[model samples]
Target: MILDVQGKAAYAYTGGKPFDASLPSTVFIHGAEHDHSVWALQTRYFAHHGFGVLAVDLPGHCRSAGPALRTVAAMADW
Candidate 1:
């Protein structure tokens, strides 16, 4: 799914029925050179536990559009 935060797009995934806002949201940030697909195992594990998990791509990588990894702040901004 797509979560548009502050007009900046954040891509994610959601399973099961409609998610409940009260439920916790888990954001997974991949390691260097990795993409959201890397978290496939974790995503499935968490979802099975009834948690809302979002494995997002880092900026400049995968579906995210931007410059290459430059700094910690830049990565956080992704």
Candidate 2:
């Protein structure tokens, strides 16, 4: 799935299911230079167990658009 965050495109893998905001959500953030695919197994498990998984590709990483966040605070805010 893709979200508009701070006017930029943010990409998230939904673990093969449509996202449901009302369900429990888990946000997965990858390490430096990585993307959402890193959490493939875990996200799939969580989603199958009734969680709304959002394994995100940070800005400028993989499918996400815009400049990379320079600070931890900024990443958290996004």
Candidate 3:
């Protein structure tokens, strides 16, 4: 799924299901130069078992838009 965050498009893999914010959410953050695909199996498992998975591609990486964050703090803030 894609979300508009700070005016930019943020992409997240929903483990083949629509995201449900009301459900328990698990946000997966990848390492440098990585994207949501890194958590494929884990996200799928969680989503199928009742957790709302948000395996995200950080800004400027893969499907997400906007410039890449320059620091850990910046990424965290985003």
Candidate 4:
């Protein structure tokens, strides 16, 4: 799914489950060298059981839109 984050597009894999706002949400964020696919299997497992898993592609990475944030602090704030 595509989400709007800080006015940019953020890509998130939902592990094939339709989102249910009532379900607890879990976000799987990858490192600088990777994308959402890195957590593919894990996201699926969580989504299927009871969680709403979001395996996200950070800004400027993969399907997300961005000029990458410069530091961990920026990323965290983002």
Candidate 5:
């Protein structure tokens, strides 16, 4: 899925399911040099078992658009 976060397009993999806002949400944030695929199995498990899983590709990484965050605080704010 594509989300408009901070005016930039943020990409999130919804664990092979359509996202439902009313369900419990689990956010998977990947580390440096990685993308949402790192959470593939975990996201799938959570999403299939009554949870809404959102594994995101952080800015400037993979499917997410960005000039990449330069600081910890900026990333947190993002």
Candidate 6:
């Protein structure tokens, strides 16, 4: 599932179908220099367990558009 959160393009992936016995949502945020792809393992594992996982590459990193900088705050905002 994809969500436009206040104009920010958010990417989400789900496991199982609606009304699934396991209906849980896990939002994952990665560390600096890392993008959503970092959660590939966790996403797959959680999804296999019937949990929905939402991971996104923060702005300015990886596939997401933005800028590259050298500041803690800058990376956080990304």
> For model 5, what is the alpha-carbon lDDT of residue 47?
91
In model 5, where is the ten-residue run with the lowest total lDDT?
Answer: 68-77
- The residue-level lDDT of candidate 6 at 62 comes to 66
Clashing pairs in 6: 59-78
Tell me the TM-score of each prediction against the true structure: 0.72, 0.90, 0.92, 0.92, 0.92, 0.63
Q: Tens digit of lDDT per residue, candidate 6, span 1-78?
A: 555744766554443323233467787777778877878888778877767667766666665554544787865654
Off by over 4 Å in 3: none
> 11-68 in candidate 3: lDDT tens per residue?
9999888889899999999977899999999999999999999998999999999888
- Clashing residue pairs in candidate 1 are none
Error in Å for residue 27 of model 5: 0.6
Model 5 CA deviation exceeding 4 Å by range: none
Which 10-residue span in candidate 4 carries the lowest summed lDDT? 67-76
Question: Lowest summed-lDDT stretch of 10 residues in model 3?
Answer: 27-36
> lDDT scores for all predictions?
0.69, 0.91, 0.91, 0.89, 0.91, 0.63
C-alpha displacement of 28 in model 4, angstroms?
Answer: 0.8
Instruction: Summarize candidate 2's per-residue lDDT along 1-78 as a digit string, tens digits.
Output: 989988888999999899899999999999777899999999999999999999999998999999888887878787
Which model is ahead, 2 or 6, in terms of lDDT? 2
Clashes of each: 0, 0, 0, 0, 0, 1
lDDT (0-100) at residue 65 of candidate 3?
93
lDDT of 5 at 23: 100
- How close to the true structure is residue 21 of candidate 6, measured as C-alpha lDDT? 33
Ten contiguous residues minimizing lDDT sum, candidate 6: 12-21
Spell out the clash pairs found in candidate 3: none
